[model samples]
Target: MAKNTGGNSLKLKKFLNRDNTVGYVFALPFIIGFLGFTIVPMIVSLYFSFTNYNMISAPQWVGLKNYVRMFTEDNRFVNSVGVTLKYVFISVPLKLIFALIVAFLLTRKSKAVSVYRSVYYIPSLIGGSVAVSLVWKQLFSTKGLINNILHSLGMARISWFGDEHAAVWPLILMAIWQFGSSMIIFAAGLTQIPASYYEAARIDGAGIVKQFFFITLPSLSPVILFNLVMQMITGFMSFTQTYVISNGTGDPNDATNFFALYIYNQAFKYFDMGYASAMAWILLILISLITFIIFKTSSTWVFYENE
Candidate 1:
């Protein structure tokens, strides 16, 4: 019995010394964080979504009441969903196109290209900040610099935020202005294409445009898909610019009332924590559905070298 017990201890020690065991030990902190922070918060929020909880009072179970109110009773919820979809669809595509164009242009061999890339990327680094949003608000104000430019060009100075239709444009434009990260990704993709492919295309009389369409685009499709999904997620969650610009009122008849801003207003402004939690879950579901659709369709467009 003593020899058998010593043999079992030796086996256990070997198992613990294995690479997988060591790796798990190193990864224990991240696993703890993921469970404690992410999973726990998500579970709590899911519970709260079905309750009536203000910040001050104990949460009362309300079942599907919060979700029912969101769909049937809340006009603002409907408006916010519409506004957020519009912003995402318009701004994400434009940002991707602009980023690709700039990346393509910057690929030429030149010493100044690196400097230009850094300068262009600065907007993305600061674009989401309150100060930058404030600057953008002023730039698009009725009597601001944009109106002054229009006046100089013999065009009528337009009301940017007063009109419901026009109010969403400034927010969309601001979203498009932060295309630097996508541009950097595209630039990296462009560099990875083998020179031999371009050489063969050139030998076959393929012009620049043809090479771009046939060679460059196909090779970069995977990167494009990645940027598309990431940008879509970011666009749906946009809040700071709208909050700062519209003063959190979603003003001019709620034209710029993005989904995230509406969630904020519900949680903090109205003190409706349960409803806000429901909205957040809905946002998560919407984003997941979109991401799933993109990934499912990606096989048709996203090329991989390994395949």
Candidate 2:
């Protein structure tokens, strides 16, 4: 009996050893890379958020001074937050709605469906680029393409970038034009919805609107939630288009000033690395909280067919 127990223990030890070796082999690269690149930087940044670390000088511990200053003293930070919220609220829903409409159109059987999808998606690929923003800046200039076209039609040229109120509309338009990513996601979700449901609805004398509201929407709720969350995050973090369009100043009157751009200016332009780190942490918290709220509320509205 003692020999039999000893043999079983030996076998168990060998099996455990083999499993450990294989697990380590598979995880080694990820562990090394994460520690080297992500974990270390995250730790460093957290420490820096409590200090005064300009690039040229050693960090001086400042406690919560940076955070307090941001909340109390920085009007720019407040304005940027407001601007970011506005952009996120306006752009995300519009983009998602437009994408859904386009995706629905694309799902129809048509000879030019592929071409239309390609054309719609092209804007998304190009829109976020600095080069594209530069082109947009020119095109929306008082003497640019849009104004020129209006002039050709004997209409007065309107100020697009000159006025602060009007300047933001161009950026909003640019964001709306890049609905392709959301459209692609919606298209995939639409494809996953069974055609049998639509056929049954049609047999029951349901119209197109009825089929969409009852059959299509409930089925695609998960993808809609996904796109909504992603678009909100992306719109909130938007910087490049604003930076390129405003030439990094967030002009005219800082109307294009976004939260990420504000952080960038704080860190690099003003050499307020510690303050910028604090702002980054704040942004991280904001995004996490918003995402959490969305997920928490999702159970009420987001339909999971498999469940």
Clashing pairs in 1: none
**Candidate 2 C-alpha lDDT tens digits along 201-235:** 99999998898889878898999999999988888
Leading candidate by TM-score: 1
TM-score of each: 0.93, 0.89
Score candidate 2 by TM-score against the native.
Answer: 0.89
RMSD in angstroms between candidate 2 and the native structure over all alpha carbons: 4.0
Per-residue alpha-carbon lDDT of candidate 1 for residues 1-307, written as tens digits (9 for 90 to 100): 9999999999999989999998999999999999999999999999999999998999999999999999999999999999999999999999999999899889976779988998889999999999999999899888999999999999998899999999999889988989999999999999999999999999999998899889989999999999999999999999999999999999889999999999999999999999999999999999999999999999999899899
Candidate 2: residue 35 Cα off by (Å): 2.2
lDDT of each: 0.94, 0.89
Which sections of candidate 2 miss by over 4 Å?
Answer: 1-17, 109-111, 149-156
